[model samples]
Target chain A: MSQPAIETHDLTKRYGKARGITDINLTVNRGEIFGFIGPNGAGKSTTIRTLLGLISKTSGSATVLGYDITNERKEMLAHVGYLPSEVFYYDGMRAKDLLKYAASFYDGDFTQRIQDLAARLDLDLSKRIDDMSLGNKKKVGIIQGLLHSPDLIILDEPTSGLDPLAQRTFFDLIREENERGATVLFSSHILSEVQNICDRVAIIRDGRIIETQSIAELRRTAVKRVSVTAAGEVPLNLATLGLPAGSFAGAETEGPQTSFVFNGDCNVLLSALAARRLADVNITEPSLEEIFMHYYQDGADRGGAAHDSAAQDGAQR
Target chain B: MNVYLFEFRRQWRSFLAGTLTQAIVAAVFLGGMYPMYHDSQKDVEKVLAGFPPRFAAAFGITKDMFSFGGFFAFIYVYLAIVAAIFGALWGLKVFGREKLDRCMDFLISKPASRMGLFWQKALVVLTGIVVMNGVFLGVALWVRTSVGATSPGVGQFVLMALAVGGVQLIFAALGALIAVLAPRLHSVTGLGVGLGILGFVLSALPPMTNESNFKAISPFSYFNVSQMQTQGTYETGYLVTAGALCVVALAVACVAYVRSDVKA
Candidate 1:
């Protein structure tokens, strides 16, 4: 197996009494688009900043492209392209000027690379940076990050202010970059985008990773919604058909129709439904948002210790 | 080398603006002193009827007020003020603008050391000061030759300008240090100007009060242009002290800059 493109061991960042990110252990594989899903103030940016060496980590070890992040910051930074959440640019500078200024730092034919990327992204190089809109500014940032063809591309909320078309174009560019052997670690609160692009995702909540898995695995383990139409009173003991007892959370009855929400394996629920004598039944797969909500809510209720234990188990795997 | 050239290109326009402003102000100040030079000789005779010519000579005015060196000295204080202000402005802007524009990351990401950046910026400011003084000296020489006067050799005039440039450099380095240490202030340029004025006042006060001890505290007093006028030369100790203060200020700035976190 190839070495992990990026790995962090028990990363913790504390700002005085407040916690930044606590014990975040993550591993991202090469050429994979890994999504870091979290809500606002969930330390997603903090983790990305730490990885880029934009901010110091309180205690942890992280390696990118086989270089230690702390000891070999400049060397590691050369191989990593970072897009900060908040973008700032020099005043009165044209986009082309800014790109050239940034390009001067790196070796190789960066000018041609920048020109090609700008053309592909449809960015107007002659426009002044301050005059550009937020979406255009984001495009400028994207071009700068990817122009060098870095080994690891770390983006914090890469599609926050983009229109749907722009977002799709960005994802396509990211896919192309990945195909070129670059690994991507993108953070987002929108689950749909993460679901669409990411090969694996780590769901973070309240400064900790609650779950990390492939989309397919999450879908298979996520709870299913079941709607059953019964001719008469439905039996409460549905587990007799082989579904887990706790799977049948509750049932809603409207005259002859009774619908149940199951919080367990969808396949088992379907088997139980097939064995039942129901007049009508419908099953719907949970959306990524629903799955994320379930895991986040569950983790919040259980608190940090349980989440850490589950994360440890995932890490060990 | 690319980083240095890039910074130079990026800062050229602003530096040009500052240099032009310095030239205009210096022209107005030196031009205004032209009439005062001719009037001072007549006034000296009337104001000191009983004083000996030796006493008048002690003050270093030989009644040839139109001479290039004398006229240059007549406006040297104002010229120094302009040079100091220009240096301070450049210093503050060079260090502080990066923080304000959030471009420190862009610069630091390059293969340039922090101390190297500080020195490069200081060099740029010093170069501009030299160029500005060169223009003033050129103008003074033109005026002297047009009126058919033979003045001091070019080397002597340049040495005197270098002395003033040394003093300007000390204040510029100090301004850069302040900008690096306190980047959040909105009025860093104003602070630099105020500090330059304060240095001038502190340097002037000790001499005006005839206290040699207090003179050591101000870098300006150490570069005593008036004493240089009487002796036709500057003290080696003053030049050493000015050079030492500039080095210390730049050292402090470099240490602080390399260690301080770049606040975006």
Candidate 2:
């Protein structure tokens, strides 16, 4: 396998005595859009900052494009384009000037590239950064990060202030960058975007990654939603039917429809329903949000153990 | 080199504006001192009548207040204030503004080392102070020539301006240190202004006292424009001491800045 574009070994950051990100181990291969999903204050930004060397790590090591994050920060930074979670710019600088200033650090035909990016992102370069709207500022940020065409792109909450149309455009841009062999590590709270764009997702909570899995694998392994209708009352001993353990809420009787809600694998319940008399049956795929909640809710208790196991599973895959 | 140039260009406008404002203020203060010089030199004997020889030796204010040298001394206090303010403003912005704009990440991410950033900003601040003092020196000469007063030679004026620049750098370095240590701009500005006022008060107090040792603690005490005019040179020991303080302050600031966690 080709070498991972970004790697962290037992990466940890501590703010005084409080753990920021503990024992964070992950890798992103070239041309992959890796989503870091987490709630607020979940150390998502902290990990990104550590990787970029914006904040010093308390222990462990990280590398980008095979360059040590600490010792070779400058060389590593040269190959990485980063978009901070909270975007801000010099007060008096025009968007064009800001891009030019950023481009000065790299050697390339960055002017045409920046202009092309600005046109595609719908950002007006003539406007002062301070005077632009938040969404426009974010667009300018995206342009700056992608203009240099670096090998690794680290975006923190890249779609926060973007409209739906612009968000889609950004996703397309990210995909194009990935196709060009850039490795992306993006963090976002929007699960749907993660589901749509990410090849693999790492769920971080309270300074730790709880799970990392491919979309298809997560969907297959996630708890299934099964609904059933019986002519008589709902079965009480549903747990013994080989279905993954979950609550079996009592049946709801409509005018002609009787439905039961069971939080478990729909296949096992369907077989049981097939054996018995059923007026109606329906099975729906759980939404990404539901699957996310399932992991995030219970995974909160499992902590680092779950994270290590999931990372191992992902590595094996 | 490009990053340094870029930062210089990016911040040049603000630097120029600040330096020009300081120059204009210094010019105005020097212009205002014209009337005082004329009044003091109206009669040499009358001006020196009540003054003791010891006071004259201490303050270096002779009957030559009418000349360009005395007039320069008269305006030195105001000029130093202008210099201190300009230095403080530049110092506050050099490192503090990067943190405020969240651009520190971008700057630090570049190939530039933290020590390099410190020196670059210091050089920028020094350049600004030079330009500002150059403008004021030119204005002072022009004002003296127009008023039919004997202007000091260019070398003496340059020496005085260089001394002012050195004094200004001490404050600038102090301001930069404050900005690095303080968490917010308000605190940095407050500390800078507070230190300026404290230095001014201390410099003024030492002259009122009989002891010279007490004045050694204040940077302003090292800048004696009157003595420089009479002796045709500044005290080398004092200048070296002030320069040493500036270097130590900047070194401490760089160390603190590199180690501290960036708030952004």
Candidate 3:
């Protein structure tokens, strides 16, 4: 129980010049709901697939429940329950039959468990899978994944086809399982979904983990989205401002306005903008996307130069 | 074993369909026409002689066409192609069904090893072929005895019927190989049908193509019904080829499936 739920050291996968996860180092402690947040094509699925042995890794190592993924795959899988993003099953099979087939792999009888799950999810076990709606099929997938009560539960975009009510029920189920001593790795592109449930999150962008922190710490990150509309020509790039290298994120210039996600001393930015004949300046809290850009730039700037600025404003997102 | 039973449950209907097709074809074509053709051999020969030599040869006609052995061989030639088609698609369907259904990730993440999955699923294909051709052999024998096919002994007729099993086995292994190796293989049925017809065309073309090892690659060419009628066993050369092909195909499929990634 003291062992981490998952541990990966410099885990990397390369798809022959295509974008795959690179130098991913991560650890999920036992009995924790660890969020894996990223935008689309950010390698969340690839990382999960690699850990599950759906895809092979080019280099590095990973283990789940203290079992080596590649060598002890079968033993490792025995303790893992996975729900793929898209739910699909043999269409001709009744939902009950598919769940029974899934349960046969585990040691204990899941008959009562399946019934309880089916009742909780409002799923009809007797319906043929083809005749079921997409949401119903998803419920079947959920039951199949959870019937064994595996030690580790890995969900990749688990709520896409579910209704809002079902989503709420699903989240409640996950939290219930977490309380019952199960560890979860919840992968999603939706930030709020992760923020609401996860104790800690690892943010991935362009196949690299850019930031990993507690939910509160992530919210408290000193990143701001600043858009400036000046009467004069907008600065061609953020580099011409002569601000500290690590203090600001990359900028986007649209016509007479230049917008950038900024981090660190707000007064430095205000004083820089004060020198220009400013028509308007809007400094608002950054979106999760904007915060990602801030971290993305921080990764680049930290690689080339020393960065020590840690000033944060009192703005709430 | 659980996987095999689950697959058998899902696939028995399709297997029965294949068996039923062969039974109907055998009952209608052989049971209906054998006595008439037997009574008026010369008249039918005269009509068949009017056909061009290549066309007659392509359909496996020879001087012994009046005999029960030759008559059965003529019908069997086309039936073998049907069995091959069934074998190929059944093989592909066993592996490709999950991918086509988008349930590969869920099924693959189960605790079973890929090799375990491969063997169990492959057992289903072998079982289907045996069931299909087993019923087929029984029908053929029943028709032959009812029509009183006199020349080819029971041993020879049984050997000839069992040759369909050989053809099915080779094509089934080939189909599984394609499924395990090719991730994006669309239209598995189309490819199966195309390859089945190609085998028949290749076997029928030696008289025109000057017999340049073209038949070597075709499962249809791997057995001679006339030879089976006379010798009571498959040819040693083609028998070796079929065994080698089936072994190599199934072995490669097992290894590749076990090692390769299950693409989503």
Candidate 4:
């Protein structure tokens, strides 16, 4: 097999009394759109920074495109395209000047590549960087970061500022790059986009990698979003049924309706609720958003992990 | 190489402004005051002699005060201070402007190493200093010719200019060092200007107090103006220390910058 695009072994970065990443072991294989999903302050940026050599890791090691990040940054960055969450270029420069300046750092002439990307992203190359709105500047950054046609593209919230239509074009561009054999490690807050395009994904929370699995496997988990409406005297013990913390969605004891994400046996839940005078019931597969919430809010317990192995087998059918 | 060229393209306006400011200071000072002082040389000396020694010392004039060289020496200290301040701010901004712009990741993520980037930025500062001094020297020479008195030899005049440039270099190098040491700086003006004025105070203190030892504290005193006036050259020890300080500070800055984090 070809070498993975990125590999980190127990990579850790500890800020002084701040929550930096800890023991982050990740492997993004070549030619895959790998998603890095985490909430704000969840160490996603820290991990990406450590890999990019923007900050020194407190311990452990990481390699990008087979070159050690710490020791071989120059050699490795030659082939790596990075789009930071914020796009702030030098002041008083035009979009084309910024792109040309970025191109000057590489080996080949990227004039045609830059023109192609600016057209594709619908960016005005002659506009001054200071005059462009946030979205336009982000488009400039996208073109600047991608014109080199790198072997691996690392984007941190690359679609944050773009409008819906621009985001569509941006995603299409990324897909084209991926099809050209560029591995992509995309970190973003939008789970639906991750669900729509990512082949495999990793979920990070509280500075740790909570879970890593394929998008299909993650969506295929046995956890069900179940809601029920029952008459008086209806009952259920949520604590004993292994419903995740904050997963009950206000499944109040006195309310007429109760809803929760259930990861336990469906038959057991059904048999227990059979005695109730139920008026309405709904059980459906949870979206990736719901599962991502479970992984983030459920802590280190078996909230999501309990169904991980089961989900892989469930996908077979 | 591209980084260096880009820095020049980005900062040529600022550098031109700095150079113009120095030229204007020289023009106004020499153009407005030099001829009046030249005609009333004896009268001015008598007035200066009648003044309290402490007040005279405050102006950093020790022995000679009549000739064009002495006149040139009179303005060198203040010019050097201004140059030093400009260099300090230039160094800080050149090295850390990306941080202030919140765009460190944009350049630091390139294929170049951090040290390579540091040297390129440092070269920009050095180039600016050369251009600033070059323009200042030309302006001072033009002012001297207009005064129609050329007592100070060409070499001595050049030494005085070099001394000011050297002082500016020290401050610029030190400023670059401070920038690399800081993770990020919001406004470098406070630190740059504060330290610059402090250096001026320290250099002035020794001459004001009649203590040669105070000269050890500031690079401004490193190029003894009297030595440049008399011998047409710099003192070997202080000059070597000044040069060494730049080398060491720049070396340390490169090492620190290569390891320091670029904060957003």
RMSD each, Å = 5.3, 4.3, 5.4, 4.0
Instruction: Give the runs in model 4 whose Cα sits over 4 Å from its true position.
Output: A227-258, A265-283, A300-317, B27-35, B139-152, B183-193
lDDT score, candidate 3, position B76: 72
The 0-to-1 C-alpha lDDT of every candidate, in the order given, reads 0.72, 0.74, 0.83, 0.83
What local lDDT does model 1 show for residue A274? 73
Please give, for residues A1-317, the per-residue lDDT of candidate 3 as tens digits. Answer: 47788998878999899979877778899999999987789899999999999988989999999999899898999999999888889758899999999998888999999999999999999999999988898898888889999899999998989999999999999999999999999999877788788998888866777667777777666677889887777543567666677677667888888888878887888778777777888988776556655665676667622211221111010
- Candidate 1 vs candidate 4: the TM-score winner is 4
Cα misplacement distance, residue A239 of candidate 3 (Å):
12
Candidate 1 regions with alpha-carbon error over 4 angstroms:
A222-285, A314-317, B21-39, B44-74, B105-123, B133-156, B183-192, B207-219, B231-241
Chain B TM-score (each prediction, in order): 0.80, 0.81, 0.95, 0.94
User: All models, DockQ values?
Assistant: 0.31, 0.54, 0.56, 0.78
Provide the TM-score for each candidate, comma-separated.
0.81, 0.85, 0.87, 0.89
Cα deviation of A289 in candidate 3 (Å)?
A: 6.3
Tens digit per residue, CA lDDT, model 3, B134-202: 899899889988987777988788888888888889889999998888867678889888777877777
TM-score for candidate 3, residues paired by index: 0.87
Order by TM-score, highest first: 4, 3, 2, 1
Residue B133, candidate 2: how far off, in angstroms?
2.8
**Which candidate, 1 or 2, would have the higher DockQ against the true structure?**
2
Model 3 segments beyond 4 Å from truth?
A220-262, A265-290, A297-317
> Candidate 4, B249: how far from true, in Å?
2.5
Candidate 1, residues A213-316, lDDT tens digits: the string is: 88777776656656777645764345466776445544566765755556766677777667767777777766778777766665665566766786776666
Residue-wise C-alpha lDDT for candidate 1, range B213-237, written one tens digit per residue:
8767876656655545456678777
